[model samples]
Target: MDPHGYEHLTPAEAIAYQNQLRQKINICELTTPIKTIAGADISFDKNSDILYAGIVVFRYPDMQVITTATAISHTSFPYISGLLAFREVPALFNAWNNLYSKPDILVLDGQGIAHERRMGIATHFGLLTGVPTIGSAKSRLYGKYIEPADKLFAESPMYDNNELVGIALRSKPRCKPIYISPGHNINMQQSVDVIKNCIRGYRIPEPTRQAHLLVNKIRIENGDNRTKQMGLFD
Candidate 1:
């Protein structure tokens, strides 16, 4: 599906689009070995129309940063709780186009199937790009579960009604848990396993953590100036 034109969609239209997109989400085991993985994030100032998107690719297992891409774009979509993909993915798609080294897996700092419509930013991007993606959200948007043990890698199942949606993972001791869910072209178990492997003494996984840092750094470097631009760095 094309990843454009969403900025002009009304809330109702966006929700309907999400429902349509959710039908195409394919959650299954990854068929390819992961040699490279990426983390995606977006940053913007409060009440600002400008969005700074970042995608960081890393060498898998070793988790060394390899490629970084960034994009700046103005969004017209209002900040709706469940419709964030419409507001954010256009700029992220611009950044994705700037990426020189596409990874085997893409981890996003948002919901996946763990959403009200099961169409979070990660899943939306995955369907748009046809890439294996996972959502590693810092908080839960849907579902219920008992908190996991306060230890590294402790995880508990999260369910919506009777259906399994995601996992609540304690990635670090003392830190609040993060939510893990398959975005597209991947399954729940594989999502948790990939996130576990990406953790490196941090509350957030390496790929997404690095991506968060990168986007924030770019936003700071650019200061309050906002413009439409796309940049790639090795």
Candidate 2:
């Protein structure tokens, strides 16, 4: 992995590489119904080059906060489109390794199956960790959306050159839609249902929303410049 561009792995072996990544995480099946889901997000101080990674765990369906972990690290690589997982996954894992409770499914704040090779940051992370994950991005990475007028779940199908990749869903009535896709060991509809259940009267799900804010919160607390209240949409 060169830590830049899509040159880390070839498109031919990307799927197999992803499968290899998923094999590392111990996918323990729960005897009880799923009760918790977590989200992870990261922010970078472009000036100082410090990375702030945050994780928020919440009770499933109910979306109650359980725990939070945030870690700071140096940037591993410059931001690139396809190879994004390598840049932030290290810091995210740092935060995740410190958690007492592990989540059943991770609601990632990035794209999943909606990628060109079905391996965006969310999918790459899920595949690497073997944790079932979903992408809940604020913008459509690569898709055409109908942009529904009335429903909170105003959905539009995501496509990559005629391939149906994922769904763009508006979890709230007026708020922007979240780009959703199955990351690993999960179907698209289940991903959508799980994300919807995690909503706690906000635009993004509680876990992700909390993690998003917490990422900047830690930066601000540490006197890092990544906490500039810039526009959410980029």
Candidate 3:
């Protein structure tokens, strides 16, 4: 599927697509002792002509890095808001395929139920892969919440039309919060707990932080100098 063509999907078509996709996601085929978790994110070249993705897998409790994969593809879609999954999925899944240790859960840098039809990249990928997944993004795509001032687990529930969508979690003191949402096979609180369990030093969790670094590293190694492109916060 051409990411550029996603824009052609009408509002009704988008909703239908989402409904069709929901049929494939069970959201119950999940393991509690998720021994492995993976993180995925994408980056574009400064020229915005190339897309790069990184996937990092980590063992639970111990948090040992087990595997890493990186992939690059010609940018197939223009940078369009609300149509980001189309742009990133092609290359990102390639990276997912390259990994040796399949993770029990996947963390994406997009939303889960924060989109037009309560679907975003994380939800899309979760359904496509049938893996328990969640979205931990840095910004809000929709809904409203009272931003918490405290750090270290300060959070507020995010809502849209009174529907619980996600949570804004502050993992660090005085730092911006990360948006948390269930992608598949998880609940809202579990999403937050999983993210909290994965944190190490940085604002983002270790697996995701490493994945972000690796994507940027790949960009640099491939001569993709997009002003270092500034890593996506999450």
Candidate 4:
């Protein structure tokens, strides 16, 4: 494999690659207006070989799905903690190539700078694609915090060793909070605000939720060899 390619890296190499790129991740406030947002996700078949990736672009605030792209490919990597980008991002790259319009920001259904390794899928993908990205995950990866209020828009800081890494966000009343983190070219607060704007009465942000549904639909239409929920990254 090329030095930066994910094709043939061992688990150790993958971890090292993440650490190497971690320094390049930029978590800064979004300085411009966003009129479009893209949500991305990937799913795998049994034995973790065949992978499906999807991207859903939506008009900001309105959350209207405007464009969608999907791709399927075989992966050689296994499921490993802190190194999921290797298993998922290649297929996403394929789908990204098919997009007719470029979104202003990408909201992914996985951890971003909130990761234990500081290089989750969203962060890694952002660095690779040169796109601003945010991570809005359904569960915690590495952080601790007091629970945010259950009401919609409630949120609290998530910290790793006293360093604030992300937010535990309540997107809807009575639903479990989802975690939000900056991936690249955007800061934590900006990420939170973007997610809040994309929500449409659902637990997950609308862009990511729509992308999740699209990938699952593709998986089902193609054939589900396994009953497991799809891996969360794009």
Please give the lDDT score for candidate 3. Answer: 0.78
Off by over 4 Å in 1: 225-234
Off by over 4 Å in 2: 1-32, 226-234
Worst 10 residues of 2 by lDDT: 23-32
lDDT of 4 at 183: 90
- Best-performing candidate as measured by lDDT: 1
Indicate whether candidate 3 or candidate 4 has the larger TM-score.
4
Model 1: per-residue Cα lDDT over 1-234, one tens digit each: 456788768899889889888899999889899999999999998758899999999998889989899999998888889988998999999999999868999999999999988898899999999999999999989999999999888989989899898999999999999999999999999999989999999899999999999999998898754333322221
What tens digits encode model 3's per-residue C-alpha lDDT throughout 1-234? 434455566655655777777666544435568888888988776566688899988888678988899888775455556656666777887888788768889999888766656677888887767688888888889778999778688889988878988899888887898888888778777888889998886678777788898898988788767464455432
Model 3 Cα shift for residue 122 (angstroms): 0.6
Relative to the unseen true structure, what is the C-alpha lDDT of residue 102 in candidate 2, on a scale of 0 to 100? 85
- Candidate 2 — what's its lDDT? 0.73
The global C-alpha lDDT for each of the candidates, from Candidate 1 onward, is 0.91, 0.73, 0.78, 0.86
Q: Give all TM-scores, in the order shown.
A: 0.94, 0.81, 0.87, 0.92
- Candidate 3 local lDDT, residue 216: 87
Find the candidate with the highest TM-score and give its number: 1
* Least accurate 10 contiguous residues by lDDT in model 4: 225-234
RMSD per model, one decimal:
5.3, 5.8, 5.0, 4.8
Q: Positional deviation of 62 in candidate 2, in angstroms?
A: 1.3
Q: Between which residue pairs do clashes occur in model 4? A: 28-187
Candidate 4: residue 3 lDDT (0-100): 22
**Pairwise lDDT winner, candidates 3 and 4:** 4
Give the Cα error of residue 20 in candidate 2, in Å. Answer: 8.3
